[model samples]
Target: MERLQKVIAKAGIASRRKAEELILQGKVKVNGKVCTTLGTQVSSKDIISVDDKIIEKEELVYYLLNKPRKYVCTVKDEHKRNKVVDLIECKERIFPVGRLDYDSTGMLILTNDGDFAQMLSHPKFQIPKSYRVTVKGILDKNDLIKLQNGLVLDDGYKTMPAKVSMTSYDNTSNRCVLEMTINEGRNRQVRRMIEAVGKIVSKLHRMQYGCVKDDNLAIGSYRRLRPHEIKTLKKMANEGISE
Candidate 1:
């Protein structure tokens, strides 16, 4: 059994917070009776409907993709560009956990589980994400420090503080492999943070997100999350699924 608001939210009726409002307003009905209580508990056996629309339980799916550059991270593109789901080619609906810019690439988590999806994508969780970035010019100590700290983006929002280190470098080519760890996921964050510090990211590859790492997985190939990996992820998220 689960809270009625959570069941309503999982059914895609509304957010959990909003579902409570609907419930209190007498808009939700359980077993053909009005349920105006905020703390109602329900199960699959309980017939639930909102605004006369019967709720349907969607199948939960999880997928991992080594997203490649030039492919957008969305379920459907209005302009018909290739999307991340195009690579998976699965019937179970899935959505990208976080986003990778069109010019960036790396391990992307996809799932149809709405609760897991909300936890990973929302800012509160602050799931650590690591990136192996290649910069155009050699970044010095000052350059590294500024990117290590937060900054006001071009859009005017201050970036969250992060961890940065030089994993590899080439003085001759002026390119450096910098490992970046960020708790917050923002649009074009790693690239913009570096660029704001007077350098350009030539190539960006995500090495880790949350506790999961690519670990020699071939590009354009993917595999299921190992049992141990799933367990670790549940531990990190501080939540678990019935599966």
Candidate 2:
């Protein structure tokens, strides 16, 4: 037997955490009975339903997408905007592993493997994510050092120390382009980090996640992750990685 939420997540219905929320909302049922309990367990012989639809485990799939700007990273958008998942034509119930701001673009992972999603997304794993960021103003050595050493955001949350290096500075435009790698997954963290440093992020693009890179994927296009890419990521998740 396994926890109901785990089963639901493994079935590609939702993430384990979201599955728990569905359970508490009475949206999940087992053997025709509504179950709001968090740890309720079930076996293969039992019937499982989420929102009245029966669920069975799905063949896990993983995709690496070069997301385009203006696409939200969600399964459903009430505003009817373009969703990242809509960019892929897979039959599995795949969802974005983590998120990027609607206006931010680049390396995004979509997968139906719930445990793999949890492994990379969970804060404890500290999987390094690399981003190419362009800010509105030139960042001095002090600014770069502050970011490298970590700074407190407006919300009083201090970010973990990051690996920050300036790639270019345009004197004419007063814009600075830099590469930053951080392992923590705070909400809008890169943008917020720039805000904390008294700069505005004009453009933000994730370049890599763990061992996976955007490579030659065209904007809004996706492809299956290579076997070694997935293996290296899982190893990084289990053993951690350096910046």
Candidate with top TM-score is: 2
Query: TM-score for every candidate vs. truth?
Result: 0.79, 0.96
Per-residue lDDT for 84-109 in model 2, tens only?
Answer: 99999988999999999999999999
Judged by whole-model lDDT over C-alpha atoms, candidate 1 comes out at 0.80
Give me the overall lDDT of model 2: 0.92
User: Where does the lowest 10-residue lDDT sum fall in candidate 2?
Assistant: 234-243
TM-score of candidate 1 to 2 decimals? 0.79
| Best model number under lDDT | 2
Error of 1 at 10 (Å): 3.9
RMSD of each: 4.7, 1.3
